[model samples]
Target chain A: MDAFQAIADPSRREILRLLSRDTMTINALADNFDMSRPAVSKHIKALDSAGLISIQNIGKERYCILNQEGFDELQEWIDYFDTFWKSKLKKLEMLLNEKAGK
Target chain B: MNRDIVHRWQFRQSPEIVWEHLTKPELLSQWLMANDIKPEVGHKFRFTTNPLLKFGFDGIVYCEVLEVDPPKRLSYSWKGGPGNGKIALDSLVTWTLTLKDGGTELLLEHTGFSGMKNYFGYLMMKNGWGSKIRKRLGALLAGPGK
Candidate 1:
């Protein structure tokens, strides 16, 4: 799953939000949602595929942890827009200065 | 999971000059803070505010270079501190420069923020880094102190 697909479903986003606070076992997370274990597991699989979450087997139970490194790609995309605004603001600053000089 | 913030600026100088100021320790100290910065990857640096005014950064702003592409991009990790002793959150910051007709366009991005840690850290960086840092230090760069 890509970034867009991972964030499309509210359930997946909620799961990510929960994991961000702390790692949790599959059963622990299933307790929060009304869905069944299989449904929650499916959501976890999608998140893992998207690189948004990671799973580790701790003896008998598996725990899910949030992974933030994937968001760097998204950040790189957003930086382009930021460059645009800075140029615009600079133009405005110059225009104001020119008018004030008159 | 990662909360990213981007900030940008337009400097009244060429990309070369802005790049120089950004990389050079002395020039950076003029606008950023008084500290030493070795111009190499994995090199560490510190930025300190004036002790008299005591209104600047609470502690040394520690940074490590992650990437450096001249006249285009520079990325680093930044960590600040509280005056008392506790170190603040660590975040990745990147600065990009593009040559424009009038001047150089500066882009700053800070990411890798985990959730809300403290009230002050949230407030200070909630906006982007370029705008916030420029508002505080742009005038100095535009003027003659350095």
Candidate 2:
């Protein structure tokens, strides 16, 4: 699934939120939620496929860490919205000034 | 655990000019906010933004300069407000100025954000700092003046 789709679910978002702070092992992460280990593992897998999180083998355990590179696409999308509103507001302000003969 | 955001801008001015504007009260007020800054380490200051009055930190960035290397780097501690019952959420904001062929490259990093754990705080900080640095500061530096 895409990044947006993967983060749409609250469970997945929570997993990402936790990962954003620091890396955690699968068992440590599973302990935070009431879901079973398999369910948590599925959420982690979906996030991993989306390139939002990466798993690294540390000793015998695997740790999941946030990979912010995926958010660049999202940031670019938001930047467009920011530019659009800024220009639109500037045009509206100019129109209002002209009407007021300023 | 370095949860800091770094932003860089290349300005068409000398490092001294950029540094002056960054540290001077009048120039900083135009872009950053209104504050009484002495440009000395341990000097306390407060920045007030009218919009921040509602959420309580509009221009309420209480800070103290930690280090100042002229035309190069400046580091300061950024606190939220009065030190009574406040959680003392402090961050280190450092600015490094490098002389470039065209002009000067200003690099800013806001680190040590251990207290911004909540979603709303994080969102507000992301939007607020991004706008101030990318837009307002850019406009000020691009304006006709040293």
lDDT of 2 by residue, B1-146 (tens): 22445666666667887787668887666555688876788888877655332222333677899888898998888776323435324567788999998577878776655332333234334434333323322321231232
- Scanning candidate 2 chain B in windows of ten residues, the lowest lDDT window is B136-145
lDDT of 2 at A30: 97
Q: After superposition, how far is residue B68 of candidate 1 from its true place, in Å?
A: 1.0
lDDT of 1 by residue, A1-102 (tens): 554457558788778667656789999999999999999999999999877788999999999986655444333333532464465445544643454467
Q: Model 1 segments beyond 4 Å from truth?
A: A1-102, B1-3, B50-58, B83-86, B115-146
DockQ of each: 0.02, 0.03
lDDT of 1 at A71: 41
TM-scores, each model vs. reference: 0.43, 0.45
